[model samples]
Target: MLLYHTIALAAGYLLDLLIGDPRWLYHPVCLIGNLITLLEKGIRKIFPKTEKGELFGGFLEVILVCLISLGVPCAVLSTLYRYMPLAGLVLETFWCYQLLATKSLKDESMKVYDRLKNGTIEEARYAVSMIVGRDTSELTEEGVTKAAVETVAENSSDGVIAPMLYMALGGAPLMFLYKGINTMDSMLGYKNDRYLYFGRCAAKLDDLANYIPARISGWLMVAAAFLTGMDGKNAVKIYKRDRRNHASPNSAQTEAAVAGALRVQLAGNAYYFGKLYEKPTIGDKLREVEPEDIRRANRLLYGASVLSVLLCLGGRLLVQFLV
Candidate 1:
């Protein structure tokens, strides 16, 4: 199992290295998007305009989406384990890693960096808008850089850390299941009039799955920041200050640490779906975010991901010894 896991991870890293994120094309994750479209259509049936119908819709949709997404895909993959063994393991790992955004996150972020460096604020904003939920139509280059950095830092927990945690605990099936839940949450887990009812379960389930892993990812990022020759003092400081303000329990830690370490303010007022949302500030009073900071954030993120894999290897060894 451990060998399979390693092989899967290595294969995924190599695949991503060889070929970057195919976001504009046929990503398997997009199938989930189609699935959401179908579910949204079905949601209207349960959410007929009645008293509390909207409320009930949110809960049921979230629950149903999570169960259907995590359960069905994992069931299919797990059944393959019976026959194919090694091949099944590799395939599963590759898919799980695809669900993860570690490399994709970094690479997409760099696109924005490239744009910012060229003084193409428009292009940078457009590139950043692809990755984050925030509005970028009017953001300055510095804001664009900050958004890229913050998203990279936060998703380091989601796209890399949390998925890896699940794999270490329960191998591929569980890891993929967690990814499904996260994917569903990202797709439909909104709090607005439309998704507030139906996406409730997915949102909550995502929160539950991320609860532990996020914090672990955060601490790991702190260590990684220091390891990458960043200031340990500020890393810890931002973690303490800004980690709590993230909408998710776990995402905050890594973002805060990176923000502090880099000495930049992040997560302020931003537009989401045409509305401005003001997030509480993280980190100390700061300078304008530069493309260089995005590089630093990626450096920290890569180190943390490597650190996680190593620690996972250690824990598995410890378990084998105990057994």
Candidate 2:
């Protein structure tokens, strides 16, 4: 089983690097989002609108989503392994591949870079709006560039390394479960009136789940900066200084690393849902952020992802030897 898991992990990583997420296919995360919406509506109708009711409702929604995420894949994979082992391996590889977002993250962030490079501020803003939660409507060129770089940096943990760690631990089931929680957080875990009470459980769960992975991701980026010929020393320095700068415990971990690696500052005040947020700066502004920094951040992201895969493989082997 360990050997099979290692092979599946490698194959999935390679597949994501080579093909990314195809637009023609229906994604599993999309299905998870739909389930969250369905369950949230039904649960809200049963529970009162008070804080306690919303909190409990959010908890129930997470439980149901996690169960479906784990159960369906477990049943199908187990049945296939019993009847046809090779077929099961193929399906498992595909499932694991779908769980990762390495190339997709690079591709989406590059669109913003390309637009900005071509001197299309409006188009660049549109491209960036697709990925980030913050408003892009009135951003200057540098603001657009900063937003793109920050998204790539932050998602380096959320979209890539975290899923890789979960998949390594429990294969596809745990990976999808993590994704389900992440999706719930993305959809409903806002501080706005609509979700502040209702999405509290999801926000807390997501934070807890990402707590360790986010730190691992930070150190990994520092190492990757060295490997990719960036400022590793500053990456470490800024990471130590600014990792806790964010409102969320986990977000600034990677953002600080990437900002230092590229020798640029990130995370200042920004507009979100039409409200201005006074965010603290992450790193020193030794240099202004450029559109090219998006590409550099993607390079760091890929480097960190490779390091994570190697660590996961080594850790699995060590556990197997001890057991």
**Residue 289 miss distance in model 2 (angstroms):** 0.9
Predicted candidate 2 versus true structure: per-residue lDDT over 1-323, tens digit per residue: 66667778889999999999999999999999999999988999999988898888888988898899889888887888789988888888898899899999999999999999885899999999999989999999999999999998899998999999998898777888899889999998998778988888899999999999999999999999999999999999999999999999999999999999999999999999899999999999998888889999999999999999999989887877887
Candidate with top lDDT is: 2
Q: How much is 277 displaced in model 2, in angstroms? A: 0.9
| Predicted model with the maximum TM-score | 2
Instruction: Specify the poorest-scoring 10-residue window by lDDT in model 1.
Output: 9-18
Q: Which residue pairs show collisions in model 1?
A: 57-197, 58-197, 58-198
CA error at residue 220 for candidate 1, angstroms? 1.0
Compute the lDDT for candidate 1: 0.77
Model 1, 69: alpha-carbon shift in Å? 3.2
> Cα deviation of 249 in candidate 2 (Å)?
0.5
